[model samples]
Target: MILRSPYPDVEIPEVPLPEFLFGAGFGDRGDAAAFIDGATGSSVTFDELTGMVTRIAAALHERGLRRGDVVALFAPNSPAWVAVFQGVLRANGIVTSANSLYSPAELAHQLTDSGATMLVTVSPFLDRATAAAAQAGLPDDAVVTLDPVDGRTSLVDLLGSSATPPELEVGPGDTAVLPYSSGTTGLAKGVVLTHRNLVANLLQFTPLGTTDETTRILAVLPFFHIYGMTVMMNHGLHRRATVVTMPRFDMAEFLRVVAEYRLNRLYIAPPVAVALAKHPLVDEHDLSCVDVIFSGAAPLDAELGHAVARRLGCVVLQGYGMTELSPVSHSMDERHPDDDLNGVGYAIPNVESKLVDPETGREVGPGERGELWVRGPNVMSGYLNNPSATAATLDADGFLHTGDVATVDERGFFRIVDRVKELIKYKGYQVPPAELEAVLLTHPGIADAAVIGVSDAEGEEVPKAFVVVQEGVTLTADDVMAFVAERLAPYKKVRVVEFLDAIPKSASGKILRKDLRARENA
Candidate 1:
């Protein structure tokens, strides 16, 4: 079933987004429970959350913050993390989320790039946040710690100042979030998402499929990332659905939550899907109740997508969106949701997507692979502080030139083939590493796989396979290469197989392709 755009054309709001998000759930007020921490069984109702957010907003406002201000949230996924997310919105400030797991160097880059004046973080991350702040030229007033230490103000105490929330001018064009994109070719760049960009996405998901008061979701996906921020946090709350938040994914616990909460909707990345489908432990846990399984951030193989669906008797839907797009431009229509269970089904409400040649701007026809370009309210305003990169990625026409090469079927179903910049040129024909990796995942013995291009003695780039074997399974390099050669085209075949314990991933769940490229150079 082709997903139809509800608006056909993206409808931009004249006002800012806090008004939209605030109004979305307040009516439920005391009745709606917003977040349920899966780990601790702790839950926060919408009214309680809004109260905390109001106090947080009041404290921040008293501390000299106002509209259009940029604040950074660098912490693990927890009730506090989410409270602060909404607090920033209520305070009329933009938020830039940094992963709690990031190294000082990685954290420093985003802090500096986004020009975040103040930061809210937990105790364990104080040193890293302090160092990053200094590097970013922020002084003592700029760093605020949530779990108080000697130097930092207590978040709880700060909230006691006033029950009243801050009021300021914030609009659709006024930036609301600065989520960094997982740049395929270079350093991660901050994608500027306005309040409209965010609210539009929340609305866009409304028409994608069936989501309402009855829907229950497993919110293990990181809130700092675009996918979880939009699909799990914003959308779930907008619909007044119960969100069972898992700080991290443990296979047994994930199944436990599904069974206990009767979780109907699940949004997962490719790696997690691989674990659910192939892991033996999955059998121990009953996932028979799941309604929607969404895989994004990376490609999910059709065989794997079909396997999970068949096992649970649930329709698997693959969605395609990026940090800049408020992340859900194409979600399968629930009516025909299973039609492209293997495909990233049709455009979401009010969003427009086009496939074009990477080198040339010319559009492609049905089934022809090309770089995908998207434009909508869901699309971000631009990259933070980097006009050059922003200008390069987003043309004057406002379409985000996503570097992903994909093909669309006649029915509006699309498949992300590989990254345009990451494609390996082998003997002049383009070799998609993702394609080879998908084939690698289909192998029974393989638990995880990442494909990168490496230079051969012949002075041409060749596909190299990095394989992680399943527990208790063993394989030789030649064996894995032979397995790939049988399935892939001659040029696209894996020429080298390197065994790895596991593939590295960013907090947002993107495989660090650049690290593999560095290893290739090594």
Candidate 2:
């Protein structure tokens, strides 16, 4: 059989997207704890949050922004960061959430590519922001500073506005969120997510909140990443559950939050699993409230998941999806547990998945391994400004061809087998090795650097770099890893390195990663 959805597409609401979710669930729960920001020790209620969002929309409208305009948000996990996002959405404007640590050049690339009209960022990055804004064709007035900055549109001023929006209509099909995907081999393309696309996925997993009332969830994954953005934050808020936010992951500090907040659910990536299995700090914290721990982005070793689950007295579950899919296509709930930890879990409701043989591009048997393709409302409309790429990734019938090598069992569970592309998923974040290779080449002392993903203790992969230095210059593995660390995001950091004489390449000069993996095994 060819790859076709046995089920039809999930229904999308024809109503205007932004205001459609107001007062739907969590009635009279506005005063309930919604977000507990760890960095500043601040807690915000649902009512407080919606009010802030409304003001943000009013201020943006006052500045002449209209529906479909794009705003860029570059900040960590803070209450303010989320408020800006909801404000952007509530106004019927889209937001591009950039990695906070991204270099000015990186920010400029995304801004220019996405044609963002405005930017909201922290005061600390003003200089870089200003320069990047110019490069992206934005004016000084377009820069909205989230904190006290001498010469910028203050976020406080926007928050103080009390004007009501024009009672506008929005719907699930309208574009609301614009997150970039580290395209398999090129520039990161903006993945357009309709409010309905995201709202649908959030509601699909809302039933998993059975214990959320008594359980606080650790929100360490970057909200900028779709998995963390929708799965944890949006879902947690819709459930009226408390979210304990961590701007950055610190092994020691992470364990402390669990004890401090009595956290019950931990939505983490594979690296955390590897650390918990051996990190001494895991033993010190009180994790009694932890009931379900879901890991994603990178692969999870069944052995490691089992060991960590046994040690922590919690259930370790694995999940799978990509940015183009509004992230979550499937996950292991309490019912399936570790039986399908290696698999992403059963096909989620409203989603139809298929496993196609690589050579023939035809569907395979229940136990056969192939490429996983999906058709659902959550699938992106297409890549921004790149029709060729959009056509290459999304099929004629709207099925997204997820390049992961996987197999689905008779029970509908899918397991990722290998990868067909050069993207590196470090703890659920895309760290394309080619991007790193391009950066490494700019260093004068470095003759060449070839980066590849190496398995961590938990079976997830991190970039392990092999470098060859200029004949006259002496270099060490430590020097190379640190060099990349200064330019990459936390998850994209290079953890291990080795000095190499040469990197295997083709006649046209493409790094042969499979050969490198084979050499590592040998």
Judging by lDDT against the true structure, name the best candidate.
1
Clashing pairs in 2: 15-171, 16-170, 16-171, 17-170, 17-171, 172-196, 297-428
Predict model 1's lDDT versus the native.
0.80
Q: Tens-digit lDDT track for model 2 on 138-250? A: 88889988887876778898987777664454566678888887433556678888887787776555543364555577889888888878877777776677888998888
Q: Model 1: residues >4 Å from true position, as ranges? A: 1-13, 148-151
Per-candidate TM equals: 0.94, 0.80
Deviation of model 2 at 333, angstroms? 2.2
Give candidate 2's whole-model lDDT. 0.75
Looking at candidate 2, the ten consecutive residues that score lowest on lDDT are 1-10
lDDT of 1 by residue, 1-522 (tens): 122354455455566665676655567445666788788888888788877888888888888888878899987677778788888888888899887677778888898888888988878888888888888888966788777678677687777876466665676778888988765567889998887777778877676678788888888888888888888888877777878888777888888888887888898888888888887777876677798887877678889898888777787878788887888877777766547555777777776678898776678877787888887777777887789988988988777888889888876777788888789999999998888888888898999999888888988898888899999988999999899889877878888888999898776567888888888778
User: Cα lDDT of all candidates, in order?
Assistant: 0.80, 0.75
